[model samples]
Target chain A: MSAAVLVTAVSDNPLEDNPLEQEKVSLLALVGELDYTNAERLQHDLQEAIGPEVCNLVIDLTDLSFCDSTGIQVFLTIRKITQDRGGSIALTNLQPRLEKLFHLTGLAPAFGIQPTVIDALKVFRARQSSS
Target chain B: MTGDHGQQWPIDEDLTALRERLFQHAAQAGMRGERLDDLLLAVNEAVINVLEHGGGDGTLSISQDDTYLTVDVTDAAGHLDVRHIPRKRPTGTVRGFGLWLMSQLCDEFTIQRIAGRSRVRLRMLLHRSPTGAASPDSVSGDPGPDESWARSEVRSSPANGAGAHVDITHSGGTAPSPQQS
Candidate 1:
């Protein structure tokens, strides 16, 4: 009955060994509920995907049905790590429930939130272009 | 849900089974959308607190009436200190959201420790009465005469967190202040 958190890498870069050859952006889609039981797993997956070269992280929560305080803690941890490395974390495709949670926790301003994955990517692209 | 008078589930070290049961029961009780999610999150957080800090195991008893659903989580460890309950959500730290979030999601939240066992009670308004107001009787945790099943589930022990006595009750609006602390 444990909720599964599936972290799928959506980026096209196939470079396995060379960090310089890989794209700087990492797009990860989180599927399933991220709660106390699976929050640590999701954090591990996200951390593993975010290497030194991958600064910008885009997380698609399209298929996520449930999240609690534990999930939020993990997201905050990842956001802090990403920000410290001069990268940004964007959350896309949030369900209305999650949006309400973000709003209630007063954490909506802590991360980049977009309506769609394309929009999230555009935000990262815009940030990159400006720099 | 309301169909079951007083269903009791054991809160184990692995909360997966308990969580699934609670989710399905809540969904069956007509809670939908954000309200349902809120209830689940609040209850899950309470259960997590029990497992993490309240001697590693507890009992979750769910009971409902026409206008409200009530969940009572009881654990042998009476570790909750009313004074330590955060009045506001903590900032710059990620670990303190459980109790605060539970308070924010439920219409009525209470923590009580009598003797040695601790009980965290959560009540969510199911719907407004026909007069467009919540039923007044729903405010009381007093179970009806016939619904004694939930009351029977609570057991007390003298050795678990002995001498700790606390009664912290919070009722009314569930919204926290707009500003984070």
Candidate 2:
């Protein structure tokens, strides 16, 4: 009863590691780095890659190196987007810098920052089975 | 050869130009690849801060030694507080991430007041041959000062220090009165 896209990415680019991924999620979308210079691209890619079929979205960022306020805004926007579509989002491998960013911005509690990609995927599967 | 040269341009806007200069030097000294891009990002953010907040009516200078690249941005503004600004959500919500990213990316970052000008100097180490020249736009950093600090640490030189200075003029800057203060 759902659809999805799973992105495995690597990046030295500020916007994302992969610029060509576009799919729906009864699945997870793993992305890294969403800065002002590239937030729109991230949004477009995310929207194109994610959907209601994917009950839980997982963003793996163990390899992520940076983010600014614009990047944080992207997170808020995506969270709201997933919620409206009757789905959820989870972030794993949260780097120390990213962790500090979340706390500084008062968004730590609002995000489901898991410890690892494995945990995030497990949670999503639980959600899928429960429904 | 990459920027529209003029006086009083913001650093955020001139990162690519400044970095082009860096890449040229780094290449001659044999630097290349993602490392160059990373260095550019770190330096660009810092330069942008200098351009935007460090002073007014300014000219920045850049120099490269055998192993390190030195960039100085100065203007006639009051001394900038170099202390780290805690990472927090944007208060203005208008995309102000310049200084924050600079601090995150710089290795041996320092901000100080010198000769009536604010100076921010950043260094990045070179470990690759100059090839696949850096893109005109990009930024990156880490939690260590190894790259930056290494270059600045070798200070017991027998000769003069590499050139580093900037001039900023504001209050009716009548073509700058020649006053050596």
Candidate 3:
């Protein structure tokens, strides 16, 4: 009985989500590419999306596949801006490698990188509830 | 066409200018991930350490040689612990993370306690298209702080401090990595 088949996983997508009507958490889901190619746009988008009223900003990276210095700068810049505005920021669905980078750099404790959007939501809710 | 090489702008802002120039060069050289951000932030921190800690004026040299874009900061902050980190986090210890962040950014980073002075050197590979860092030079010298890299001062938030985190992901960026391990 010869019965065996092989399977391979293929994904060309840049891990991201479509722009949904962000509420409760005010999502700023970045799609396309997030490296130097579009990092400036990412920074601009981030700054524009954030306002004094926005207390919670959830950046969904489930669809992202790449990141460069510009992208990192955007994150750093936005994070600073968010703090200055007295708001909370969280990350959801970060890839494993990205997760490791965060941990190794001692940034894990500063940013909430959750496995899923649902998990991020929980963390955000808990923070809100307590504060 | 004269040859006088001493004061090229006031020594005060030179470090910040040097940092920005190198950052642009590194970005152009295609250094990625924590390396780029880490280099920029760490350079500033290190330079400020020189200024605030050592209270000395210095010049930093940055060049993109064949395999790596080198940063050599020659400053007077030789007395401080260039490589040591407090094992236990005492509340409000600001001096540690500047050097700490520098360590995490470069592939081949060194803090050499050279003759009479210190030389902090940072080497990041000339990666083809950004996104990932190349392998580190195994023979990295003083892991604490290169006895030499180079210096500058800039205005901004304390990079390693402030306790803020923002999510980052590259969308349709440049040349994707050859391997995804």
The fraction of reference interface contacts (C-alpha pairs within 8 A across chains A and B) present in each candidate is 0.49, 0.11, 0.06
| TM-score between candidate 3 chain A and the true chain A | 0.72
Model 3, span B42-104: residue lDDT tens:
565556555555556655666654456667665654664332422222223333544544555
**What TM value does chain B of candidate 2 have?**
0.51
Better of 1 and 3 by lDDT: 1
lDDT of 2 by residue, A45-71 (tens): 766666434444667776565555556
lDDT of 2 by residue, B19-94 (tens): 5666676566555654454455555555545554655345555555434455556656745634323233245443
Instruction: Judging by lDDT, tell me the better candidate of 1 and 2.
Output: 1
DockQ, each predicted model: 0.41, 0.11, 0.04
TM-score of 1: 0.78
Give the alpha-carbon lDDT of every model. 0.70, 0.49, 0.50
RMSD of each: 9.1, 13.8, 16.5
CAPRI accuracy category, model 2: incorrect
Q: Whole-model lDDT, candidate 1?
A: 0.70
Interface RMSD score of each model: 6.3, 11.4, 16.9
